[model samples]
Target chain A: MSLPKVRVPYLLLFPGFAFLFTFFILPIVNLAQTSTQTPIAGGDTGEYEQTFAFSNYIQAFVDNKEQFARSFVFATFSTLLALLIAYPLAYAIAFKSGKFKNILLVLVVAPFFTSFLLRTIAWKQILGEEGFVVPGLRSLHIISQQTTLTSTSFAVVAGMTYNFLPFMTLPLYASLERIDPRTIEAAGDLYANGITAFRRVTMPLSLPGVVAGTLLTFIPAAGDYVNAAILGSPTSKMVGNVIESRYFKIVDYPTAAALSFTLMATILVLVTLYIRKVGTEELV
Target chain B: MATERSLSPEARSILNSQISRRGVLAGAGGLGAAGLLAACGGSSSSGGEDTKTVRWGNWPLYLDFDSDTKKYPTLEKFMTETGLTAKYFEDYNDNDEFFGKVQAQLKLGEDIGYDVVTPTDWMAARWIRLGYTQKFDAANVPNKVNILDSLASPSYDPKRESSLTWQGIMAGFGWNTQKNPKGIRTLDDLFAPQNKGKIVVLTEMRDTLGIILLAQGVDITKVTENQFMNAVDFMAKKISDGWIRGVKGNEYAQDLTSGDATAVIGWSGDMFILASENEGKFDFAIPESGGTISGDNLMIPSTASADGKKNGEALINYYYDPMVAAEVAAYVNYVCPVKGAQAAMEKIAPELVNSEYIFPSDKTSSRLHIFRSLTPDEETKWAEAFQKAQGN
Candidate 1:
């Protein structure tokens, strides 16, 4: 509808906009301001000096570059690997399989019904030094004696992938399922083999799902302090863990707020650039 | 609304200098784009005005309520004497998380509606630094003489005159009999090859590292920057080497129960939970090298209403009554700041009365040391070095 005709709908949207305005937008602005406000060092009637310095950003990046780089690398690698494992399983149900497709879909989304913390913790218990997986592996002689999975990067990544597999697979399945099977059959009719048919008709069309699923799996995993806090060691701590330490462990509100806003701004820039290069609309 | 309206244009503008409405609206917009956060909760619970309330934020499972009874004796007597009602809260899960939530109201520079707030040692220091807490007059708390001469005048509060301590306890060593029949006797026991993968320590920056710092024979309380660096370096090395089991909450007890971890740096109050669960299987002890002794104190917020502060200041003194302290001691199993409360508890519940964990003998007292404040640069370097050492 034209703007003149749709004034009522716009009016209807005011409540939601007002709610978001009061709760969301106000906090970020306040966060940026609070981050810069320096508490009085020496006296009463002394107010915090409002200085807009960018050192908080420097601390998040240059000062703590190692953890920042590790977080980015983890996000990228986990997303790519999730896409690889997810694509084949989704393809089987969408392209070749006839029966049990809906049943398989239910199974994919089922784990989410339980507590995410519980599931992540279950993985920790299973992967601990004397836990289910390590003991079972030892009994079968699949690994050497005395090797434990607890407090390792492998355990962290494995837990991440397992927790987020449904996110990756469901989107890929939806994208693959929406494709016309006859297009592949049409390629075969023109004398293309199975590989050629899939490469030409299916792969190009499914890129959107691959991108979406990768994002759905990866972005949340980047901010996952819980996984590191429970399943991994200090070596496995992420940027989220650092943010938490500043916010809670130390009462450096200015530094904590500075780190929070800096992380947020960095994520925005990275996402904006990615969208620009990859065509944001296609990510759907 | 009252204060804002009372402000003249100049005063309002001054308040707005820090954060204007536009700034708040902009932040709300950004948060909307993020997602809805849970609403800010008020101070604990209150049954309402018919009862004068004291809003408390204490650790979970610390307060005692009988299975069939929710009786709190000190609270009852306080109500009887003062004709004021009691509304105790167990809302504080961790000290830092509570600070994060309360910071907003503090910034708004208004009544947080809490009559009393409690936090641990260094945290009390942070409140004093931030000016978020109120100052008290020593004259009001004449009953302060009831506090042990030894417990008075902590490093955090030089006169022991400002903040009222919630409970003071030693953050020492605890062991499981299931793993070490002979016990992990000293700080060196933590780094032993045999104990490599089977140890659990606390995540509190001061307690964990300070214990290790003391074990190295460095005085954690009186340390230079270089000495402090050595302590962090040592801790970071052990953490990165995977010699430590996990840093966590009170679940160190759970880790011991499941045999995932054998011994840990633990609080004495938590020993009550573990001893109940595993019976004589576990015990808490101070190592020979001496671990950090810490305490929690109740602080008055700067914004406490004048009327409330007047009464609350007196109420703080009132709790120091020997009978009141003894009843509180039975309910809360930490060090009785009140001098003679232990003997009173002995007359009440002889089992808990004799428990040495609640009242450490004088020998343990001589070795105990309270934590010292970190300089800003030192704090920065310490947090960074620790983080780097924990890196993959």
Candidate 2:
């Protein structure tokens, strides 16, 4: 008889997987389930109920369209700005610069040594009314004294940009570093100017990094409350603060969980569609 | 699927090793901890035949415990004399956060494993209504006389039957002297042009609005719908225009003290910290119109018993004893609810005893409107206004 092919030890994954399922997936599932429960007639829980209030999602979209739109606009603008800045640095590191590349790369990664909150707060102070940038602008008369810089949406975007810039830059560098320079030389020799050579050969190759870095920065930036809470004025508060207030400040867990799920679902659908449109072939 | 019978014994054993090692190792730590807990947990405070233990939870850094000093002098004395060991747990930071934690346990009518907890006045009222707490049996507390007469007949708990306040503090405006030496008398100062981008308000929902309503000359005791909109609209305008620096809570003091903030809506005690640190850099002032009032209270959790609860209640009572209360007041630099603690504090720290921030003068006292709970609509309106104002 022929020897039987061995089956994979797939069942072996169950134990480790079960641990993750219990800890991580279970809570998310529970939050979704709790979001569906209807409120009882008499609410000594009049405060809040696990009342599967689907209206929360509607309210999140309709009632607070300004906050939602602001978050999206912020995420989009910051990611685009980051890509503009990072692509050049990534290109210089990957194709142009030599010798001190490792040292420069280390310097790029150095901010990660400090706490994320601390760095963000530092950015806030640096951009405050009396901050280095604002005062310098005032003295030069670039912006007048009464001009509000900190405690606005403008400041929140600035803070988010400062904090997540490295996330965008590092990935772009990683992607660019993997591209073979000879292909670009070949393109240059054929008929291309430096810009054309970059557009055809370099940009396509680094698209994967652009996609990955954009997603990394955009997802966290959209949900960020700390940046908005500290840097933005009251009008600049985002969906994160809404969810936080629903759960923590107000104890309205059902609606909070509902808003949370809505955010998760929307991000998933948008990111997946973005990926398909961009196409994986050019990205790699 | 494995074709185990056809497999070599070693392969099956390795499979078992891979599966069991991680599971068993992970469980191993948990089991060890569980065993260790079982062994030591009882002796720590099982409440055997002779003695009892009471557990209490409070805010971080609220109590005066000198870090360089190894012992808790107050607790040490309580344990020595009463023969009851106090198990203090610093687990609470906010009223709502702690309430959310214990509400489920309370709903199920189970003990949250704490004998006493400290919540502020409005939260105490809500908790009492929900029956999450027990009424104090005054006869059991020998030191009940130390309870302040003013605190005894408050509306939340008539006859002082259930809740008791430990300290009272003024909730008012504390401006940066760097901005104005003329003093910010009315609520109008916060909205004034020169103070724009320099104003700081607490993020707390009720306190922020209470002061605003009072400044607008509305009756804060009864919040009318029209009154709420007027207050919210004014706040909304301030927020939308880049007139406010930022809204914050406890960190308000830090912002003010560092000169990051030129003026702020601040708590008296928190402001005192800045005042004491900066000397003349800051001033905690009660606005001429009105400001909110608040007191942190100690209450018996529902599970507290006649014996275990008595020991815990005595501790609050003990802290209120004239001399003891004065020491705590001076250390905290907050309003002493114990009427005579102010007099006793005067004998020791004359500056604090006379300070209106700590012990409000009669004129300031009359204008202070202790904040009450808002109807759901008021809160949502306020939240909506706050969001709109901040440009969120």
Candidate 3:
């Protein structure tokens, strides 16, 4: 069963290539096909045929523009919040935590042990009207009696940030840990202050992590329906919820597929522009 | 998705003793992933691989489950007596969601991993109309005669050929008793100012819209398209005005338990379970005008193997036995479809024998109305309108 020397790389790449072809590429092709379909003239619900109805994309977009915008807005807010919180946390673990770095890293990833849904639901309870947080704020007159946390856009964004924090932290830690402290010393030798040395040296070096962390956090958050479904009111729903309801509830497969393709294309364009703007060739 | 932290210690224990279907809403993704894994792993069990095996896909908490043993006692008994290995899956969350999951496979004429499935009245109609279901063999289910006369003939399954009624569901007002001591008996009560931003409604279009239509003096059984759209418009206005918190399924119980929802358009059975779990903190009332009544039917899919169909019929017949039906009715607290299940309840859980939820009296039954079956065109169009109203 010996492979020819020139054929070895192909042999080694076989499983990965096969998996991607079957799970990813094929589904995308099928989705593209489905996106252009039209329902049968007199068929039952969910019956569709290949009619090349590209207007489905436009219809889906026009109908769900609010949700699409909401998805991106929520994703952007969560990504920025996650970066702001995770960068400091990851910095402490990478540099200041010293011998306790591994333990601190474990603590950072501890939430993954529980199901994502469970954690999100837990957040719902913690922010719910009966939960201590809302009642406490009300009693202190910090919040009005009518003010609640759960089922609000704020809760949805908070949940997204919490759920995706680890995605931001680990990559930032890897990039930050790779930075040499001497780079900072060299900058300081050039008469730079603590903030300046870090910003000019360490921060620039961690751009790859920022790029990777932001992408990781943003992509999943943008597609997330759970956090919004559990914690947000109907008004806070995102595109993912629309797609889900379209596919399952309405049985409008073409519209759902069109929405999905549009989402993917939009994400692709945004990511391309983002990478181009950030100019991070060494993204994690 | 309500966690233990959302409940009092007492409620948590009660919720633990019974498998609250709403609690497993979190497992929806996990279940889908498991199905994918099974397909990829090539360990998937084909239907009717053996006549001694039968698999049923049903709604969560619809059967009698024992928390300590982590099993359905009636199911275990059926398996023991029939010498069959019966697998039960609470794979159904919503009619559309579950049907969508299996529809592609059904269209391909492939085994959908279950011999029997319980779809609601409308969904059952859809399945039959689509010819996706198999008619039962009368000889195999002699106990079919035990079905209630009222449920014996549905528009979809006249003469009860293709489907058998599993449980009757009543959709009405469910509210936190403490929050609305006066009770919510009318549509106006459900939309009161005090309950603003705290009301949830069922995603079941029939129930939610049917209640709204009834309140507006439209007869559900003869509801016109204009009448339905009026109700839809009313709901959309409420949602846009931020009066309604959510349009949900069984998980509305989660909202009620967590105090996120003060009132709901919820099922009678779920309200009963929530009331017991929370020490009567919750209560259900059939609206002064009326409430919507429907049934989930157990039917074998057409793609099921002959032996699987036979096994499925046996399973259905077993459940129809009044004694067996009584046991499940006691736990599920839904309206039992078995004709003599109420009399059977006298011997088992006599307290529930008089319970209106499990066995509604004539007066209570008179207040329940079945939503008219929609034409296929109306089904799609109306569902689209309903989803639009929910802001989906």
Best TM-score among the predictions, by candidate number: 3
Candidate 1 docking classification: acceptable
Off by over 4 Å in 3: B1-44
Pick the winner on DockQ between candidates 2 and 3.
3
- Cα lDDT tens digits for candidate 3, A56-104: 9999999999999999999999999999999999999988997899999
- Candidate 2 reaches a DockQ of 0.24
Model 1 sits at an interface RMSD, in angstroms, of 4.7
Residue B276 CA displacement from its true place in model 3, Å: 1.0
* Per-residue alpha-carbon lDDT of candidate 1 for residues A238-276, written as tens digits (9 for 90 to 100): 777777776666445566677666666767787778667
Q: Is candidate 1 or candidate 2 better by TM-score?
A: 2
Clashing pairs in 3: none
- Give the fraction of true interface contacts kept by model 2: 0.42
The C-alpha stretches of model 2 lying farther than 4 A from their native spots are: A1-8, A36-42, A45-53, A92-103, A188-193, A281-284, B1-54, B70-91, B109-113, B258-260, B303-311, B346-348, B373-392
Better of 1 and 2 by lDDT: 2
Q: What interface RMSD does every candidate have?
A: 4.7, 3.5, 1.1
**Order of candidate numbers by TM-score, starting with the best:** 3, 2, 1
Evaluate model 2: give its lDDT: 0.70
Best by lDDT: 3
Model 3: share of real contacts kept: 0.73
Cα lDDT tens digits, model 2, B1-392, are 12211111222222322232223233334334334533554345433322377666766445544333433456667778777877666566787788888787778766665677889887787777778788777776555566665567666787667777877867778777668666576777766767877688877756777888888888787877788777778776776566667778786765665456778887876765655455456666667777778887888887665675777777777776777777666556567777677778767566455556556666657777866565444444455555445444
How far residue B215's Cα lies from its native spot in candidate 2, in Å, is 2.2
Evaluated on CA atoms against the true complex, candidate 3 attains a DockQ of 0.63
DockQ of each: 0.31, 0.24, 0.63
